[model samples]
Target: MKEFHDIAWYVKALSKELPNDIRNPAPQRLLGGLAYIIVIVACIVAMNKFDINLVEKLMFSLVLGFSFASMGLLGHEILHGTVVRTPWLRNLLGGIAFAPLSVSSRLWIKWHNTTHHAHTQDEEKDPDAWISLEQLVKSPKIVRWVYRLPLGFRAFVSFVSLSFTFSMHTMRMFFMYINEFKSKKLVVWLEMLIPWAVWFGLLFYVGFNKWVFMYVIPLLIGNFIVMAYISTNHRLNPLVPINDPLANSLSVTVPKFIDVLNFNFSYHVEHHMFPGINPKHYPLIKAKILEHWPERYFHMSLVKALITLWKTPRVYYKETEFLDPRENTAYDSLGNGLDINNIKFKKLKSV
Candidate 1:
């Protein structure tokens, strides 16, 4: 198979054909996220004003959690340079937006927008890419358990892991990848401090029981919202040496209301194709992608994507083959079963 190395030519051609609005900066769309922020504040106010009971607090926390996650996505768009190009304002808004998960906008840009986007599914460079079976075996026992507990054998219980995966990875990237961005360390410290102070200070002020319902659990919920998409974004695709949005990314379809709430985030491949473009215009871009590369694009329901992710092993034996080391079983990148067992992986057919 001929590898295209990069999609620069395709993007260049498509750029000329796209509507001008796709390139225009629409900061106003980000303003909608303010409503989520407002709702979170409102939830806090209600807890104090009504002296809410446990049941009422639970309801408010659910709203707060969803609002936190939703607003964070808006911040994602902001950080992506989709709108608001002012350096200070962009980081400020992004910092606040990602507050629920205690993510530093500066570090996030380094980890996500910089590294993850550049590397995509590159096995070594892309932090989020699935590891090879050899690498998995070399990993610590606890790390192996981490994969198996949620994404490996008993995958049905993965939600427990997903709820905090974003939070875990954000800190992991911070501690692990901080050396790469040492110059920004000071700002990242301030960025990281803001969320911890707000959430923990609120906890001490409001009491553990109250804080757990209001902020703690809500933050966990926010993490779940973020990871649910993150997990499905690229894991199903083959780990290519080069970045190929069509082959290395999968676009999950959400319902109309979710598409609106999530800032059109379900259009994963479209966003990867043009991360800087306003997500509002992603559907149009998606249409253009289909027109150009119908066979290359991937779109599926959110539920189906999650189900398939659960059924497959997290370790890669081949670029397109997933394997469970314990079972000697093989599945394709998309979780379709392969009929080979106890056979050399080289003899296995390409998915």
Candidate 2:
């Protein structure tokens, strides 16, 4: 693991190896962005213009939801200024891209770029990191059951929690942050308000049920898709305080189509190691990483990675272990089952 102890020097060396022209490839960005937007617009138009049956309508809504989630990913790139050079244009594009999700780009940048990126695996600082199982100590019997399910069942539970619940909670977080009275909070306010106002106005113009099918369900599904992909980003990594991208982030090997749809987001480690680099170029970065540090570079296929996270409890019992709250036991970071009585977690400095 000391291979990454000198993370800074390694990163500098990798930067030197990248071509001088290394930048976000405009074709990938433009093609992907436009395709997602076209999907959303086409879904809306089909729903409005055609006399489609219920099954067709349902299918269209699902596609629309997937499109909105894709747009959210694009918004992420825009906020990073990878979509275009001009800051104002990037912000404007971000507003439209994230509008369906109702997420404020300014708020997301402040939280994700500043907080999550800076403190990736730090238990105290990365808001996206695992929380304590103690938070569930007083939960109801049903809640405890949901928390303790095996991999297959837990995956289903995650879909429900993420899709139905987390989306609204995220918007509330945006509102709460807006109340902080920062100077740029107004930009976030407008970003949050404008699209929502337009959506609601359109919803009222259309009937209630149409609104529900067209926008609300899609929003839920889109947010759920985002969460599903995001959960595997760093969830399986050891609960360490250090910021070494190699040790704390994971690259999930997925189909090429998924990479295109997600804007190559499965290259999580590459993205974390070089956040400024366009995701389209991650394959180049991946080649460099393997060439330079073949023994240190790690990746898991998408299915296995998701299953591991599903089976493994999310709360950290130690910096290097996960707690299975149901059994009151600890497992190593790699998800190996171990007996609680035999484990001594005090060796962890990060704890």
Model 1 lDDT-worst window of ten: 335-344
Expressed as tens digits, the lDDT of each residue in 1-351 for candidate 1 is 125446576688699998777777788876677878788888887786677777888888888888888887888888987878888898888888888778898888888899899999888899999789778878999877766553344576665788888888888888887777677778788898888998888888878877788887898888888889989998878788668788788899989998898888899998888998989998888989889888677778888787777666767876778766555666666322222222223333322
Kindly report which residue stretches of model 1 are placed more than 4 angstroms away from their true locations once superposed.
1-5, 144-153, 334-351
Clashing residue pairs, backbone N/CA/C < 3 A, model 1: none
TM-score, candidate number 2: 0.86
Q: Identify the leading candidate in terms of lDDT.
A: 1
TM-score of each: 0.91, 0.86
lDDT scores in order? 0.79, 0.74
Expressed as tens digits, the lDDT of each residue in 1-351 for candidate 2 is: 433443476678798899887765353486777888888878887787778888887888899888888888888877777767677777787777888888777887777787788898787688677665554555677876776766346656765777855467567568656776388878888888888898898787877867877898888888878876788788777755468887788888888998888888789888888877788888999999999877666588877776666556677665666766545666566323322224332223232
